[model samples]
Every structure is written in C-alpha cells, then in structure tokens.
Target: MAEVDTEINGYIVPKNSQIFVNKWTIGRDSNIWSNPDSFDPERFLKREIDIRGQGFDLIPSGSGKRMCPGFPLATRMVPLMVETMIHNFNWKPKKGMKPEEVDVSEKFGVALQKAVPLKAIPIKL
Candidate 1:
C-alpha cells in the first residue's frame, strides 16, 4: 500500500495550489516531447518508453493502480483493429493527397479524436 501511496502523491496537486493542472497536458508537454506538435509515432518506437498511462513520460491513459482498466482493452484492440485493416487490404490517400497531408489534428473530449475524420482508400487486395 505504501508503494501505491507514494506514486499517488507524486502525481497529486499541492493542497494550496489554486491552478488546476491536467495530467494529460503534462504527458504531452512540449518541453518533454521533441517536436511535440508533430505526430511522430517513430519517436516512441525508437525509445523503450511506453505510454500505457505510466512512467510519467507518457500517460495517455494514466498511471498507478487508479489508472484506467480500459487501457489494457484499448492496448489490445487498437493494434488488432489496425492489423485487421491492413491484413484485409491496402491503404492509400486520395489522388491529390499524400499520407502526410492526411490531417492528423486532434480534438480533445472525454475521448480524444481527430478534428476531421480520417479519409483513406482501403483497396481490397
């Protein structure tokens, strides 16, 4: 229980602080991430770090015992969905668009989402 206590305290705001600091903001801080605004998945692959909501460096879901249980389910589902899609077909952008031009801008809410829904051509192979 002590281990859990310490971890929770590490993330908690000071009692007297008036400002509300969102954990998500800290996780995605520009100072912490190089080219933070860029959607560089490679940066994560190059490092041994993970963003399963722990390790402080990345906590998209959160950290510690209170961390989201749905995280594990998401971890499994996301790659599976991507794999299923890729295995079934080929992906490409529109005639005039490049993959890089495929707008990746995000909108935040209870769940994060792309500002514009992704437009892709999935060719049945």
Candidate 2:
C-alpha cells in the first residue's frame, strides 16, 4: 500500500492504495532481458543481478526474506534431478519434427503453462 500520495513513472499513487506487481511482464521485459520471449537458460550466465537470496524474488521457489520453507531441500534436489536426467538420456523432439519446429509457446494465466504439452523422447545413454 502507498504511504502517501505520490507518482510512480508519471502515474499518481494515492496513499494507502494497494499495489500489485506483474511478475509476468517484468520477466518478459525487453529492457531487462534481451530476446526475453525466447527460452535461453544461458542468459543468466551473461549478467549478474541481485534477484536471489532475499534480495529480489524472481523465478521459481523463493528467495531471501520471502524464501519458501522448502528452499533448502529444493535447492539441493532440483539440480540433482536436472543433472540426473541429462546424464542418463538425450532428449529429442518427436520423430518427423525438427527441433526448431517444436512449439515453445506459453499460455499465460495465473501461471504460465505450455500451450502444447512438450513431447520429447528420452533416449537412454
């Protein structure tokens, strides 16, 4: 809530007014991320931002002051889960489809979900 009448980015915000931030828009903001709509996990390796560890809550689970109770377990498990999968198998798109042709479109609502369920075949190593 706003503490007093103030303007933010030119819009007047009255005191006591409740405020909500749209994390979806912020996550896709071109100014904040290049090729924001594209899936690029490598983007994170390119820059340093204080968006974790109670600094800023952005992305899955939680961080910092608003950190989730399961953070400790999740931090250890999620990575192991990912690494285990990558280590054991090679993921491939459905037969007859090109990698670039796979749909990565998302349906935005309360939470973002893939428009189409991703169908990939996992080949055992």
Candidate 3:
C-alpha cells in the first residue's frame, strides 16, 4: 500500500492503494533479456551487472530501502554452502539414472520449485 498519493506514468495513484509489481513479467520480457526463458548464469559473468539492487536487470534479493536485510548474509552463505557441498561429496543421480535424465522443470507459484523432486546419491569424499 502506498503511503502517499503519486503519479506514475501519467496515472494518478491514490494514497493507500495497493500496487502489484509483476516481477516475473519484468524478468522474462524479451526487450530486456535475450533468450529470456533460458537459464544462463554465465551471462552475468560476461556482463558488468550488479545484483544488490543497483542493476535493474536483476534484483533477486530486491533493491532500494525496501530490499531484504538478510541479502548480504544469504548471498555469502548460499555460495559457501554450495561450494562446501560440491567439494565434500561426489553427487550422482539415483536409481542408475544419468545426469541428463534429471528433470529441471519448474513448478511456479509463490516460489519456483522443481516439478519433480531430485534424488541424488551423495558419496562422501
């Protein structure tokens, strides 16, 4: 809800009116992203982009004053955890399945989750 009345793109938005920002639409807009539907983390490495809300293209943790307080901790912890897991174990697909057979389809809702739960056999190093 907006605390004060504001004009946005020629429309007068009244105070206390609920505004829904469609982040999903923005994320997949063809005008903004090339091959928008594809998962490509390497694109970030190729481009000079910031994720801490500074770059409008990607704001996973959000941006500005309303951004998440735990963004810093999450960014650090998530990578560390992933690195540690990869380093400590050898992961293989369960039931003699090949790595390529794993389903990466997403079940989208309030949060995006794997359509099929992934089962992996972890061999400790």
Instruction: Compare the candidates by TM-score and give the number of the best one.
Output: 3
What does the lDDT come to for candidate 3? 0.81
lDDT of each: 0.74, 0.74, 0.81
Worst 10 residues of 3 by lDDT: 104-113
Give residue 8's lDDT in candidate 3 (0 to 100): 85
lDDT of 3 at 52: 85
Query: Using TM-score as the measure, what is the rank order of every candidate, best first?
Result: 3, 2, 1
For residues 1-125, write the lDDT of model 1, one tens digit per residue.
Answer: 13222224467544444443377677578888888777877888777777765477777777766578898799999999999999999989989998989987768766566999999999999
**Ranking 1 against 3 by TM-score, winner:** 3
Could you tell me the TM-score of candidate 2? 0.62
Worst 10 residues of 1 by lDDT: 1-10
The sequence of per-residue lDDT tens digits that candidate 3 reaches over residues 11-111 is 99999785666667777789988898777768677778777888777777778886889998998999999999999999999988987777767676774
Residue 112 of candidate 3: its Cα lDDT? 55
Worst 10 residues of 2 by lDDT: 54-63
Error of 2 at 100 (Å): 1.6
User: Tens digits of per-residue lDDT for model 2 on 46-124?
Assistant: 8776544543424454454555677778878988999999999999999999998999987866635698999999999
Off by over 4 Å in 2: 1-19, 53-59, 62-67, 111-125
Error of 1 at 7 (Å): 16
Residue 3, model 2: lDDT of 69
